[model samples]
Target: MALIGRILFVALFLGSGFAHITQAEAMGGYAASKGVPQAKLATFASGVLIVIGALMVLLGIWLDLGALLLVIFLLPTAFLMHAFWKETDPQAKQLEMIQFQKDLALAGGALLIFALYSGYGDNLGITITGPLF
Candidate 1:
């Protein structure tokens, strides 16, 4: 079920990454509202990162690098985009907290995947080029 697991894991990212690019103007506006600097460019760049990372993981090539890219995107996004602590409204705070927690969890999953591929060697999937490490 390794392939199935990988597919499930990347599902969220593929859709989100596509949206970030295809709807950059709208997503950028949302990012701007959240105080992201250079929102449009950042949104586009983030989309690229997400898509590339997702593809790498899905294809079982350079898995470690793919996981790292995901971690890189997720951590800061959790802090910046979903700053629950900054939300004064109870409902808004709750929503942000959920999003923040989700991001953290996803980041953790990515790290776990990285550790598995990097430590155990690329025996987990198709492994086109193998882990970069």
Candidate 2:
């Protein structure tokens, strides 16, 4: 169940990260439209962060670090990209709100993982910082 959960959690980001590479120009344009500075560089950097973080989490390699990266990725992204309050149109606001909620939920999940890996509430004292078995 843990493995499955981890896999599902990383799936969207894994695809999205790769998509930035395959659809670089388009993604850069979208980022530019979003007022991101150095849109192309930001796009590629985001892709790298997303991929590395997702891979680390899914593979159980330095799970704490992975979770931290995820939090960093989702925080600004949620408030910036899914700025629901900034949308005046009802439908657009609703859509952005949903996206924002999802991002928050995902960030929560990452935080949970971070806490677990950080030895926040574990009696076992087992911390695996390498590849999953």
Candidate 3:
């Protein structure tokens, strides 16, 4: 189970990183649409961030560092892309805000994993005493 969990975690991060890399241009356009300046730069930074974060998470090297980076990256994503801006229509703003909350939740999960496993073994101390009778 621990092995499966770790593999899943690695796969998730890698997939997300690849998405950022592959879709950077589209992401930049979206950022521009949302009023972020230097949208291309922002997209490039985001791609780098995702790739580095995914690598750290997969390698389990400085998990806290990866978690912190992810948190920082998500902040702008949530605020700039998902904020309930006055310019946004009510319904769209509501939807975006919800998505922002979800992103925050994912960030929180990463933080939790970092907190729990940053200094622990590869399995993060998951254990089972015995199988059910």
lDDT value for model 1: 0.92
Clashing pairs in 2: none
List model 3 lDDT by residue over 58-126, tens digit each.
565665576667777777787778877654588987898797997788778767766766545455633
lDDT for each residue of candidate 1 in 1-133, tens digit (9 for 90 to 100) = 7778889999999999999989999999999999999999999999999999999999888888998999999999999999999999999999999999999999999999999998865677767777788
Reference-based TM-score of each model: 0.97, 0.87, 0.75
* Cα lDDT tens digits for candidate 2, 66-105: 8789889898989878899999999999999999999999
* Ranked by lDDT, top first: 1, 2, 3
Task: Report RMSD for candidate 3.
Answer: 6.8
**Best-to-worst TM-score order:** 1, 2, 3
Question: Judged by TM-score, which candidate is best?
Answer: 1
